[model samples]
Target: MATLLLTGASGLVGSRLLPRLVEAGHTCRALVRSEVALPDGTTGVRGDLADPDALRQAVEGVEAVVHLAALFRTTDEDAVWRANLDGTRNLITAVQTYAPRARFFMASTGNVYDAAAAQPGRETDTCSPTAAYPASKLAAEALLADSGLTWSVVRLPFVYGEGDGHLASMPGLVDRFGLHPAHTYSVAHHRDVATVVGMALAGTFDGRVVNLTDDAPVTVYEMAAFAGQPIDGSSEPLVNPWAGRMDSTVLRGFGFRPAVPTMQAAARDGIL
Candidate 1:
């Protein structure tokens, strides 16, 4: 099993990923900012991306780096960029310094694409990410391209599972992102995200961008249901005509399938 360094090991996705990696026969060295219990056979290294010496300590002898750390939805957009972009630069530099041969895997977002595109985003489409959230991730993706590491980036859709409760905040998302009533979005379960990360680390997919999503686009009405609210005429027209739809053909080529296929199905089964 590979000894891998996992950043953001305590966040929503990170909390789920650590156990998934452990179950897959991998030993994880997770980076954290405070005292926390390490998973069985997993080590916790106290560090921050701003501290170079700490970064080196965290990655020492790790065969792979799954960099899941990110900053999101802050009031300050600049802080978002620095955390996502500068933090990534710091991590890659440390990897180059010590674990130079280690493979790199990043968790990115499909929101990085232009929402009003002509078609559902594919690996070949260009990115014109609008917000600081996705823009920072795009900058991080660029850093990986220059890092000289074998890297794989999986662009995830709206992730919900394991009591994520992200669906409960749709009112804020609607207002913040200017979401529209007819607007559609894609989604995936947390387990599917962990599965994709595992597959990427195992070299199942690399050297290209892959959008990991479910089989269909979900409507704002469905989101309203998940939020436990009624859909009113408060929404506007979608800015990105193709915002929520994505192409996952390459992901299928890796033999990865989503366990929860849609919000409705997830709700019926109590995953949403």
Candidate 2:
């Protein structure tokens, strides 16, 4: 079994990803900011992503690295830049010094794509990054591109499911607003996000950037109804709109597709 170093192993995606990695017969060395409950047979290392010394210790002896640590807000430009860009720089430096041959899989966001007033964004599309979160992620991707290691970047859309604070709070927006808002949206389950990371780690694909998204685009109304709280009205425009589509052809070509489709399924399964 390959020894894997996983940063952000205690966050939403990382928490779910740990179990899956273990179940797949790989040993995971997880880096967390503090002590937390973890599954048996897994090793937890305390480290700050911003600290190169701590990062080096965390990656020691690991055969592969799955980087899931990053600030996930569209706001807070400074925090996003430091956490995503500087943190990635630290990790890359450590890997180069100690684990240059290890495979590196960086988790990025689909928001890196240019904010188009359309659907189904392909992997080759130009990046716009309207918000701090996407902008920082794109910067991190650029850092990895020149790192000279065997690496792949997985650009994921909004991932919802258990432990997803942003998505769980989405239902409240519907109650306050209404269905058929002005903007459209796209979503994927956390399990799928973890799966995509695993696929990249397994070296099953050659593409540098892979988009991870669901089968279809989902609107705010559809998501609200799935949460068992329908929007108040249909006339209210969807406010604060963002890009709601991604082309997952590159990911699917590697046999990775979201098993979960509808928001209702995600809610029912305790994933949303």
**What are the lDDT figures for the candidates, one per model?**
0.85, 0.78
Per-residue lDDT for 113-170 in model 1, tens only?
Answer: 8777888889888787878999999989988988888889998888777676677777
Model 2: residues >4 Å from true position, as ranges? 163-166, 172-182, 236-242, 264-272
Clashing pairs in 2: 114-128, 161-271, 162-271, 181-238, 182-237, 182-238
**Tens digits of per-residue lDDT for model 2, 36-91:** 88777788888788777788888888889999998864466888888989999999
Best by TM-score: 1
**Candidate 1, which segments miss by more than 4 Å at Cα?**
233-239
